[model samples]
Target chain A: MRAELFLQYLVSGLIYGSIYAAVAIGFNIIYNATGIINFAQGEFAMLGGMIASSLASRLPLALAMAAAVAATTLVGIGMERAFLRRIARGGVLKMIIATIGLSIAIREIALLIWGESVRTLPFFSGTEVSSVGIAGAHFSPQVFWVLGVTALVVAALTAFFKLTLIGKAMRGCSANREGASLCGIDPDLMVTLAFGLSAAIGAIAGCAVAPLTQTHYAIGTGLGIKGFTVAAFGGLGNSLAAVGAGLILGMLESFSIIVVPEAYKDVVSIVVLLAVLFAKPSGIFGSRAAGALKDY
Target chain B: MLKARNLEAGYGPLRVLKGLSLHVAPGEIVAIIGANGAGKSTLLGSLAGLVRPTSGSVTLRGEDVTGSRPERMLAAGCSLVPEGRKLFAPMTVRENLELGGYSVRRRLGRKAFEEDLAGVFELFPRLGERQGQLAGTMSGGEQQMLAIGRSLMSRPELIMLDEPSMGLAPLVIKQIFSAISALRSRGKTVLVVEQNAKAILKIASRGYVMETGSLVLEGTGQELLANRDVQRAYLGKEYSSIADEREGR
Candidate 1:
């Protein structure tokens, strides 16, 4: 492949990977806090994009984006408050099933509201498909938005987890819930906050990518599956590794086009996931028992 | 300072604590010692509000705190250094100490919180030396100290320790008991529930023995130490000899 084409594929791959990273981060948050893979995570993104697309037509763009994020955050908090909280004391297996049920409910609700058509979000920067030339390769300004948003969110979350009291409390709970509880930190409240934060992050991912992939009710399932694969590949609890694994997955999918047909992109992703599961089930950076969430 | 009245609690259809009652006055070091499956830990869990009681009440400093959840119990001036020192293993010791003051920080502000941290560091200077180390990576002795120090960070008027000497060396167990003894001087009431009756009863102002979920015996530390039945059941020949020497006979 020519350098320009190679670079173009690489840029788009980074954009896609950034979106996947945000989604996987959402997975990591809920999984770390509650020890359950939130199957409804991807739907939060889809809901955010769908909400933004519809609201943008009536309201100003920024307001629509804010509303979309706020609404999705409530949905995330609601998932924890209404369902997960009730079954939280149950086994992790039960909570996983609950999330699966929640995912279906959320997707169907979006379908009823948005109809079956794909929706578009106006680019945050401009209407024109403007490109920025880096070296010999050209990329859209939305590429920058996707990458920038992902970077900003990741940095902010890193700071929050490391520096803030509540954030540290959340980490403490994830490490040992009984220990955290003894310290007067309510693990349930931390888990609920995790749900809210994860939802907002997923929504942000959807909003960033809507201008590129377009928004649709069915968009979440595919992305959710891929995002989950990324999370598993990075080792479930680690956030930085999840993003790194996401980028690598995106690159693999993008570069495989050189050898295989473009229609078989998901085939490449599936193959990679299988290889990771077989060779290193804990993901590249995860501890051997990374997937094990202890009920403390 | 702390009281549990007719407490009944258990796990899923198998009750462990059966109508047990206990009390600790202010500035006292009290120990509850029992054999395995005697519900010693359950009694502490009931007192700390970690396990909800089927009946009866837990009160700290005159306020009923029965079944009030662990956080509320801590808020009500009671802290539990749980069994096995359930520290946040991945976090730094400093973080563990800070989290111990979670409710304290919220209610007492940073200045008081920091003072409490200083007090803990003073109590266990080793924790001060290894503030940045992971709690799990520390030695068993250090971990026990950190657990006790963490509980102290809450600045609770009453501190309850569940099996603080469970897996520690003899010297470490001695150090822990001495620390418990010092708490009485520092104006903090302590409740230590342990299987290591000999060591705990050494520092305890008063002691209770539990058997199959009920308080089988209660008396002053010396009285219990002198009780032949207590000596045969919980204390061995070595401890009995030491008690006899201390009594000058």
Candidate 2:
């Protein structure tokens, strides 16, 4: 491949990688708190994009994005209060299945409201024709936006978990629910917060990437699978590793165009997911002993 | 400091605690000794609000707190060091201790919370030395100390422990009992359940012998320790005496 093309692919990979990393982090947050993989995680992104795009017709872009994120967060909290919390007594498998049902329900609702038409938020900085040139490679400025938002989210989340009382309490619930409750930390409240936080992060990623990928009701399913692949590739509970795994997966898929047709690009992710599951079920960064102790 | 009346609690269809009742006065160390299946842990669970009692009343510091939930129990100044320690294995000792103070941290203020942390470290200097170490990486004895220290961080007026010597060496058990004894000096009420009847009764001001789901004997620690039935059932003195006689020792 030519140097310029390589740089373009790398930038493209980084943009998509940041979005995937955000989605994977969403999965990690909920999984760590509840011990269930929330399949509706991707729909949170779709909701953000769709809500923001609709509001963008009448409101400022930044306001629309912020409102969309806040609204999605409420939806996340509602999901927990209405479905997850009610069915929590049914065990982890039941809760996971509920998330799958929720994902479908959310997608159908999005279709009902937004229809089949594709939607996109206006670029934060410039139109589609506007591009930034970096080292002979030209890409949309939204790439920088996506990268920036992901980095900020990661940093903020790290500080929240490390420095704040609520964050440590949430970690307490994740480490041991019984122990946490005994310590006067409400497990239910932490789980609700986890859902809200995960949804907000996913929404931010969705809004940031909307101008580039365009939003459709059906985008959630694809994003959900890809995000899960990245999360599993990193390790289910480890968020930092998910970022690296997302970038690696994104780069592999982007560069696969050199060897395979565009139609086969998605095949790369599926292959990687299967290979990781079969060879190292714990994740790339997780030690074998630690992996053995965890329930995939 | 703590009172339970007609407490009936169990996992569905299996009645573990059948109308048991007990009380612990302020600044007293009360011990409950029972066999493995006597529902001793369930008793602590019900009082700490981890397990909902089917029918009962738990009064703490003159307030009715039955089935109030664990956080509420903590708010009422009651804390339970649950069986097996249940430490947040992935978190550091300081973090574990910090979380134990979660309920009262705001009320205690930052300065007071730090004092509480310092108090826990003072109680278990080993924990202080390894403040940054993960709870799971500690030895069994150290983990027990961390568990006790974590509960103490809450500044609970009433602290309940479930089997503090469940799986410890003789020396470690002695260390744990000494710490429990030390709680009395600090003016904290302790309600402890133990299978090690002999050791617990030594430090316990008062003791109860539970069987099935009811207290069969209640007396001062010295009286229970000298009771023939308690010695036969829990201390194994009768069996040891019989073996000695058979071997002509």
Candidate 3:
């Protein structure tokens, strides 16, 4: 029975952790390209969840999820083209302020569209799907979906950056923008593409976790903060590090319930975030150069 | 052929190139020698479209390409090797070369790209051997060769090199100069900006001396090498003037 309890907490923590890692990956994509923190990142995920939930009521689950992710990706590209790219050369402070404003605007739009009510999405494989047992504890198949999706996304991203010509150019820009520009790769286009891909990743996470977490106009605020914390914890610009940090964070949150009241989980998380940041300002796996939040 | 007429450009309020004009005809090696901060790199940069001239016109093969963006300039067949041999250090040498040929590869097919890659490898056999090696791990001379080799991957009509001799030893500089001469033999128009005046003059067909954001003198390599002012400022006091071999005297 004790072993079952341990497995439940551990497996559940890892599932939640993978979700956080997905969000962190979103933050990393734009950050790597432009060194912008992209405070609007969480909103992409929020939009994904809310949009998918609403669409699933009328459309098939697969199609709805696809549309939601695609719509969110377009929104991400629009954000870059309509605003971020215009102000890209205007220094980091300006970009930060602009993204904060955009985040607030997006949140308000969400509130207007979805209203204040929390909404639920139907389980992708259905709620009645049998759960696998570990000792006496049961683990849902949804957990596997989340973990599997995260692995697939990671694999896809690695190949995209390594194998594709456009992806290689994006990496070249990230490594040295001037060198990339000289090679006839436009930095602006690469940045816009980065935001689009980032949004798609965020939306995938949002859609994946919506059935588990439920969606609300206000859920983004907490998730955004947590994702940012994970990104910082991993050391900004290092996407792989972000995953490790997110997993550790999710596990820490899950295990903390053993000592603290479940209601105090948010407080525990905030405390841990502060403690980890104070101890290693660069996060656990961040290199000294990447420790600085913005390269510019 | 490339031509710059009365180019004036600079950063913010500080002007660097004040009415600087020069040209590199087809298949010629033109060297610009100047002291540090005299705007040698800026001149090359402006020509390469990395820096926009406040007022001037740049003509590449008789097409007015003034104030064009670097990517457009590169696509139009001009490439700058840039100062400091800035290789994408973490990437492999082949990756660097591929990126160098990005515009050409996009325009021409992969077959043309492969052929260009073969030519670049032929020029620098050492680079071919270390195609998979991380560029950052290479020696300074190897990096310079890779930088030049990378530029050659573009198969550019006019190739501008900035400070290729900045950090290399004598033997490496000799090898680099030989490569520059070899580039001329292959009909690539070359513009070299260097602080190593004496060495650069040896292979350059024509040369210019820049001082305080302006070209103070323009002459054939032999003439500039014999100029008293150039000798005093750049080439040491030991350089004997070629005055006795003066053409029209």
Candidate 4:
């Protein structure tokens, strides 16, 4: 590829990578706190995208995104209360089965409600060329949204964990369930709260990125797999590490067009995942057990 | 004050506390001494609402509290420092205490919580010093101190400690036993279960001997210490468990 083409790819990869980072952060939170990979996370994203698309048809861009995220968050809360609460005590086997079943069920419901056709977000930025270079590599407002929102999510999540009592309680529950109970924390409450928080974040990412990739009901499986792979490649239950890994994966996928075909980009992330499993088993920046997120 | 009458409790199908009965007066130190698997821990678990009793009642201050949720009981002024010194290992000593006092702190204003925090620190100076140190990284003795201190944070009217001296050095055990006694002097009631019968009786105002889910003996600390049957069974070789068995003959 020529220099201009390479620069374009670089810019595109960096922007896409930022969106992946936000999604990975949400995955890490649920995985760390509940010891279960909520496969429906991508569905949350898809829901956000769909909701944003429908709302933006009439409402302002920012307001549409907000409403979409709020609606998806409520869906997450309902899923936790309806599905997770009953099956939490169903042990590892039953809970795993329940979540897997719920994932399929959610995907089907999305397809039924939103239809199987892909839907794109409306033009958030007017048709304006905002570029300084002679090549006119204009920056779209969608690209800016993806980059800025990812940074904000990371900062907000970090602060919540550090400064809040409820956040500490969630951490405590994740570390040791029996001991947390002894400390007077209700483990069930913590688990439900975590699910709710993770879902909301997933929705935000979905809504933010919809204007670019659009969303379809059947899109959940591929996105869900990518989110999990990104999370696992980084560190199964490490939020910061997951975000970093997601960005790296995103860049790999976007940049592979130069060295090889676009398909080869995913190969980098997959290889990293295998290497971590074979060598460290915990990925970078994670402990052996990574059992931090299992109980509450 | 606390009372357990006809307290029949068990883990699942197997009964552990078979019609066991005991009581403690206000500002009293009562020790329950028994052999391993003597249902001592089970009794405490039932009292703490960690285990459900098959039958019988546990009353605190003449109020029926059998099978109450642990958190509700904790807020109602009943706290248990469970076996194995179950502190949040990843958390610091202060975090552990904060969790202990979580329910209590909800009712008190910020200032009162701070004062109570200081009071616990006064009782266990090491906890104050190690506030930022992870509970898991602390030595066995220090963890034990933090466990007791954590229970104190709840400001429970009745503190039930399960084997506080387990796995600790001899010196540490002495310090812990002394601290239990000090709680009584502070007008707080304490119920401790221990295998060290001799040391327990020394500090307790009254004592009960449990064996395989039954209360075998109960009396003043001095009386039980002198009984012959108790001498043969527990109290070790250093002191006879009991002087005689006064069975109805």
Candidate 5:
């Protein structure tokens, strides 16, 4: 491959990779807190993009994005309180199925509200024609926004889980719910917060990538699968590893177009996901002993 | 500081605790000793709000906290060191201790929280030295100490321990019992359940002998330790031989 083409693919991979990483982090947050793979996670991103674009006409872009994130967060909290919490004793499998139902419901509702037409947020800094040239490759400024926001979100979440009292309590809940409750840390509250936090992060990623990928009501399913693939590849429940896994998957998908047709690009991630599941269900970064202990 | 009255709790139809009642006064060490299936752990679970009572009341510091959630129980200044320690294995000792104080942190403010952390470290200097070590990586005895220290971090007026000596060496059991004795000096009330009747009865001011979910005998530790039935049922070969001889075996 030519150097310029390779740079373009690399930039494209990084952009998608960061978005996948954000989505995987969302998965990790909820998984760590509640041990449920929330299938509706990607819909949170779709909701952010759709809501922000709709509100952009009436509100400033930044304000619109913030409102969208907040609204999505509320939706996430409601999902937990109204649905997940109610059937919590039903065990993890039932809860996972419920999330799948929720994802379909959200997608259908979004379709009703936003129609089938694709929408995109305006470029964060410069117009579509504007580009920053590096070496021989040119890229839009929005690429920086996507990368910067993802990095910021990762750092903030890392700090939150590591340093804050509530964050430690949340970790306590995930580590041992009964133990946490005995310590006077409410597991239910932590789980609800997990849902809200994951949704907020998802929304931010959704909004960041909207200008480049364009938002459609049906985008969530694809994004959800890709994000899950990254999460599983990185070793579920390990967020930092998810970022690396996301980048690797993204790069593979981006570069796969050289050998396979663009239409078959999605096949690359699916193959990776299947291979990881079959060969090392615990994930690439997860220890064999630790993986054996987890339910996957 | 803690009272449980007519408590009826169980898992499904099993009925582990059948209308059991117990109380611990402020600054007292009350020990409950029974066989493996005697529902001692269940009693602690119900009192600490881990298991909801089908019928009864749990009072903490003059407040009727029956059937309240665990966090509410903690907020009311009651903490339980559950069976097997139940430490957050992945977290550090400091993190575990910090989380134990979660319910009162906002109410007590940052300074008090820090003090409580320092106080826990003081109680278990081993924990202090290994503050950065993961809870799961600790030895059984250190983990038990961490569990007790974590409970103390909440500054709980009433602390309930379920089988603190379940799986410890004789020396470790002595260390844990000494720590329980020390809690009385600090003016904290303790309700400890144990299968090691002799050891717990040594430091306990009062003790109860439970069998099949009912307290068959209750008395001062010395009286219970000297009781023929308690000796026969719980104290094992040495005392059981004496009791057996008294009963004409």
Candidate 6:
């Protein structure tokens, strides 16, 4: 690729990374709050794409996203209460299998309802090819929205966890469930809250990326795995690191396509994940977040 | 006052506490001494709502609290420092303390919360010094102190500690014990389960001995410490010979 093409791809990849960052951070929330990683996370994101796409065509642009987020939040809460909570508290292995089962059920249900065919993902903003000249290159408005949304979500989450009482209680559960209980904080309720919060975040990400990629029921599996990779890449519980690591993964995956065939894009991401696992085991930013996650 | 009546509790099918009964009066310290699996921790767990009692009642100031959730227990003037120093490891010492005060009772007003924080800091000045330090990074003694101090943040009428001196220096144990005494002096009721019997007995106003999930002995500190059987079996045989003579070893 020429220098200009390379720069453009790099920027586009960063934007894609922002989407991953949003989804990956969802995994981080539940992983931190409870030791269980909700494998059904991607379904919530997919719901975002579907709901937002349907509503965006009719409702005010922002309200459509809100409705989508609210719906996914309830899905997340139902998934936790109806299924995940019971088996998860038993053992780590049981929890893992339970989440996997939940994922399969979610995917099948989505397939039954939405069908297997890919559907269009509507953009949140007007799809006019708005451009900006930066130094000598132009960037798309869509890419800028992706970056802006990720930043806003990150900022909001940081504030919630740091400042609010319920947020602090959630953090208390993440760091030390028993200790939090001793302090009059209900770990179980907090775990449930974490799932809802994560679902909303995942839905927001789905809404953000829906216009770029078509929606499909089976898409949850790959997206779920990718979200897990981003969580692991940043360490299990750290939100900011998940964001940073996600963008990095996205950029690498997108840029890799220039050298290898597009068919190998998925393989490149998996390979990089393995490399990170082998190199840091904890992740690139794993140690930094490790402190927050030790109790779980 | 706090009381447990015929409390029966266990995990799955294994019953750890079998009809155990005990009571602690206001402004008093009660030490519960037992062997490792004598259901010492189990009894505390039941009291803290970490375990469900199959048949029994826990009452604080005449309120039936059996199966009351941990958060409710805290709001009702009952706080427990669990077996391990379960500090929010990633959180700063101040954050840990702040969370400790998460109770409806503590939400009375700003002045009350501030008063509680001040009281906790006064109890463990070391925690005050290391308020900004991460809990997981602190030393065993410091963490133990923080655990106690964190529990104190709730300003409960009854503070129950499970093995506060489990893994600490003799000096640290002394500090923790003295703090317990000071707490009593301030009219707080305290219940402690400990393998560190000698020190626990020394500070406790009264003591109960448990053997295999049953309450075997109950007396004032001096009475139990002075009993030859109690001294040899639990209080450690130096003060009396009945335990040694009975052993025949």
lDDT of 3 at A124: 70
Deviation (Å) of A146 in candidate 3: 0.7
- Between candidates 2 and 4, name the one with more favorable DockQ: 2
Per-residue lDDT tens digits of candidate 5, residues B145-222? Answer: 999998998888888999998889999989989999999899899999998999899899999999999888899999
Model 2 has fnat of 0.81
What value of lDDT does candidate 1 attain over all alpha carbons?
0.89
Residue-level lDDT tens digits of model 5 in A1-296 = 89999999998999999999999999999999989899999999999999999998899999999999999999999999999999999999999999999999999999999999999999888889999998899999999999999999999999999999999998888988898888877788999999999999999999999998899998989989999999999999999999999999989999998999999989999999999999998899988755443323
Candidate 2's displacement at residue A192, Å, is 0.5
DockQ of each candidate, alpha-carbon based:
0.64, 0.68, 0.50, 0.42, 0.67, 0.68
Query: Once model 6 is optimally superposed onto the true structure by TM-score, how far is the C-alpha of residue A143 displaced, in angstroms?
Result: 0.8
lDDT of 2 by residue, A1-296 (tens): 78999999998898888889999999999999999999999999999999999999999999999999999999999999999899899999999999999999999999999899999999999899999998888888888888998999999999999999999999888988899999999899999999999999999999999999999998988888889999999988889999999999999989999999989988999999999999988799877655443322
Error of 4 at A269 (Å): 3.1
TM-scores of the candidates in the order shown: 0.96, 0.97, 0.94, 0.91, 0.97, 0.93
Model 5 residue A175 lDDT score: 87
Identify the runs in model 5 with alpha carbons over 4 angstroms from their true place: A289-296, B238-240, B243-249
> Best lDDT goes to which candidate?
2
Extract clashing residue pairs from model 3: none
RMSD of 4: 3.6
Tell me the tens digit of each residue's lDDT in model 6 across A265-295: 8897788779878988688886645554377
- Candidate 6 lDDT for residue A189: 89
Error of 6 at A253 (Å): 1.1
Candidate 4 overall Cα lDDT vs. reference? 0.79
Candidate 1: segments with Cα more than 4 A from true spot: A289-296, B238-249
List native contact recovery per candidate, as a fraction of 1: 0.74, 0.81, 0.55, 0.35, 0.85, 0.79
Considering only the true interface residues, what is the Cα RMSD of candidate 3 after superposition? 3.4
Lowest lDDT sum, 10 consecutive residues, model 1 chain A, at: A287-296
lDDT of 3 by residue, A20-77 (tens): 8888888888887998888898899899999999999899998999999999999999
Docking class of 2: medium
